[model samples]
Target: MANVLEPYLYLQEQHGFGQNKKSSAPGEEGSDGKRDGEESSDEDNQAPKEENDDNEDEDGKSGSSSSDDDSEDPELAKLLRENSESPSSSDNDEQPRSQPADTERKGKGRFIHQEYDSPAGNISILMIACWTMRFPVMYMDFVRLIEAYELPYLDSLRLLPPSLTLHLTKQNIQALSPHFAPTPMHMHRLTSRLAKLMFRSYNILTPECNAAPLLWRAVRGLQGNPTLYTLTKQLAHTLSLTLTIHYSLAPKLKKLKTRDPEHHKYDNAPPEVSLAATVIVVLKLVYGLDGRKRTPKDIHDPACALPNLSEYLIAIKELEERERKSKTSILSASSTSSALDMDNDMLDDYLDFCEKALLPRENRNIEHGVIRDYFPLTRHSSTPDEGVRSEVFEDSLPDAMSAVRIHENSSDLGPGNAYAIYHTQDVLGSLPEDYEKIVNRAATWAGVEEDYVCGVVERFERRLAGWWDKVRREKAETLGRVDDEVCRICIGQLIQHD
Candidate 1:
């Protein structure tokens, strides 16, 4: 129990819910923040942490957080009450006794948040995947395969000792590539869309994120997924924001004071009761999507885990006690709006939070993205995901950019590195007998000389082992999207709306 609950234990039990709490240790920054709100509520249903060994084993198999259990310790009880109450009694007290029959007439039906939008790169890849991939392909199966295969394969190089990983030759690595990475046919249909989406969500969020958290940090500084946290503050897309509620916002909820009065005829139900009734409402009503359950393995996967996991969990609740306590959930009860917009105050906070981006000549991406500017003509792209790096060095255009180059010649329209990349992708699957066909087909498309294409193809073929080794080393510099692991769960919600 101590080991499991140690991190969440208040840094100084000496201080309770008041202002004097010294922000806990620097390492415990997110303890007060909401990481996964539903997950915290889920804890209430589990058997106690101090149960017998068999109970612990059952809980382990089911995958629940250990610390969410009730504690008899006076300090712990005070802290959980301070941090984990579903909806404060005061929020319940504020509810009206009954809803007017006319309240349903005020419903805002099926909004797309003319204000916030998805990163174009993210939209582009799913479009490509939708358009190109064979129909009847099992999405859930692909998700399962990725979880079972690709992730482990990627980590094998780093986790395995040299003795084993050394023999983890290129042939073995390339063998998995064809089965996992998007196929050549699939990738080409989009013309570097995934590459672009990569830059937008991943690159834009890291290093110098001038658009989002810049506004979020300056303004609300609320607890939510770092992506959605910054996003809810900066932009307010329905799908991303909804997912953020479960993964980040819901867990931080100590108590709520408000609930959506739209779908079920306004009510004064407790926040916990409301959430139990509407995990579906969180991500469901927006897209008719019934998202798959998020599991512990997925949450803990490095790709999905918060960048600063320990500190974010420790520090979040402290940062947003009042925000979380507002209990003014954007929870959608209506089939009409995504529920986020129902509460105009929260929505206003979202739209207005990103106002500083409007200064003239400030290289604005998301700031200008705000619908408030009313300058549709000035905004270049919906989201700031610079696709495809030109060569990974200079001439850095962050349009999801990296290693993607196109020939300027009008006549040739050379494929440049794209051909090489496609060739590499093909080489992963093609046998020697089929190499020429793959090479010639690629040459024809790019309008490049056959021999040049063949040579590029051959170079990759000879050093497939070395190539994968280089990939392993380079990815250390920056892997693809952290959301890549859990995307399948939400892809349906996002793509249909996009």
Candidate 2:
């Protein structure tokens, strides 16, 4: 046994492990020119030396340096010594010691450290894997793989990382091509997954998130392909439904006060509406229907040959109409009539009481239109002179004409004559004492009460003004767009005579 251990000891000595037992500066030579321990002079002895006993064996193994020695192999020990003395190792050596072993192990199971790669690289790998296996990969699984790789959600998934995009495009073309004869279910799964992933990148509030370019490319590449057309239409349909739901819920949301003190804002429309609107606009632009020259003839032209263009147009029109009606309904509720005819009659009676009891004779002659003219149309105006006259004219003209026509047509007095007759009474009631006497004399000559004449005129004036304003607003919003070429086309179509 001793003979066998002698060879092991010789091997360790040859590898420089034997030199570790003596105290001497590294590479220092003794006076006799041999590397070995030697007593130093007073100046060299001033430097402290580590207290390590080579004679004490803790592990019951002879020739062991120390129980705390990090390296057991002679070569490893030399390398570690060299590394510790290097300049680069100084930073690492100065770092704080690691946490206690128990502390580090406590929460180690909760998290995992994963390596990340660019979205393109990961997607390419996934595509290759799926193609090699010739099996349909679940969308959720694909999403999971993306998440596992910690890839960013790229909006340009359909056109990015040339290799992956080319593969996807090739697969799509083959699936849609008649020559390929691919399995329908397999094709459906693959395309559906791709669509879902592409759509996922679309965020309504993020202005940069746009899927239109990719979609347009797909349409152009697969032009005249029924499968592609159906897919595109389905996407548009989904967006339409989303827009409808948002519009429907907008009015019902509670009004929120914004930072502006004068204006009360509401969180009515969702962010999804912006996304849906953008997509619709992009689709229109893609088909060339968004141009100023768009017309019924252009829309119906067979030469255009854009698949689902008509359906998209119709869907967009319907959405716009629905949105318009919803907005109009809300405006009508707050700014216009909300009561039935019966309620109006009751309100009229109340106004009559106020006119007779509270209004002085001098103040009665002040016309409603004249009073309205002195007020600004909106709160931002500093002067009432801006729109007063126009508003007064808009309010009073049409009702006056209708009242006069009714008076000329009616042979007998009845509820049908109430508007004309009451208006005359109101006017007479408001007249000054001097005008009253003149009006009374004229009424007596005409064989009618002065009050009756005044009331009929007043009622007729009020009705005419209200109706005129309504018609003006409607015309401004509809037929008034003569400067816009698109509007001109639409109007020309409606008014065109055969």
What would the per-residue lDDT of candidate 1 be over residues 21-107, giving only the tens digit for each residue? 223333232343333343334342232223332353333344434453433367856895777656656576555433433354333
TM-score of decoy 1 = 0.14
Q: Against the true structure, what is each candidate's TM-score?
A: 0.14, 0.16
Candidates in order: C-alpha RMSD to true structure: 39.0, 30.9
Which portions of model 1 show Cα errors greater than 4 Å? Answer: 1-220, 224-226, 230-310, 317-498
Per-residue lDDT over 1-498 for candidate 2, one digit per residue giving the tens place of the 0 to 100 score = 999999768645432334344334434432222333354454343332222343333324534545546546689667867865977577676553454554576556332211112233344345434433443232233443232222333232422355655656754443322221122223323433433344456522211212343334333222223333433444343322222111222223233455433311211111222222223222332333322122223333221333344443343344333323332222221224333422333343334434433343345454563233544232332343544554445322222111111222434331101222123333244443333433343232222344543433333335334443554556657765534454335333322223
Candidate 1 shows a clash count of 45
Which structure among the candidates has the greatest lDDT? Answer: 2
lDDT of 2 at 452: 44
Residue 454, candidate 2: how far off, in angstroms? 66
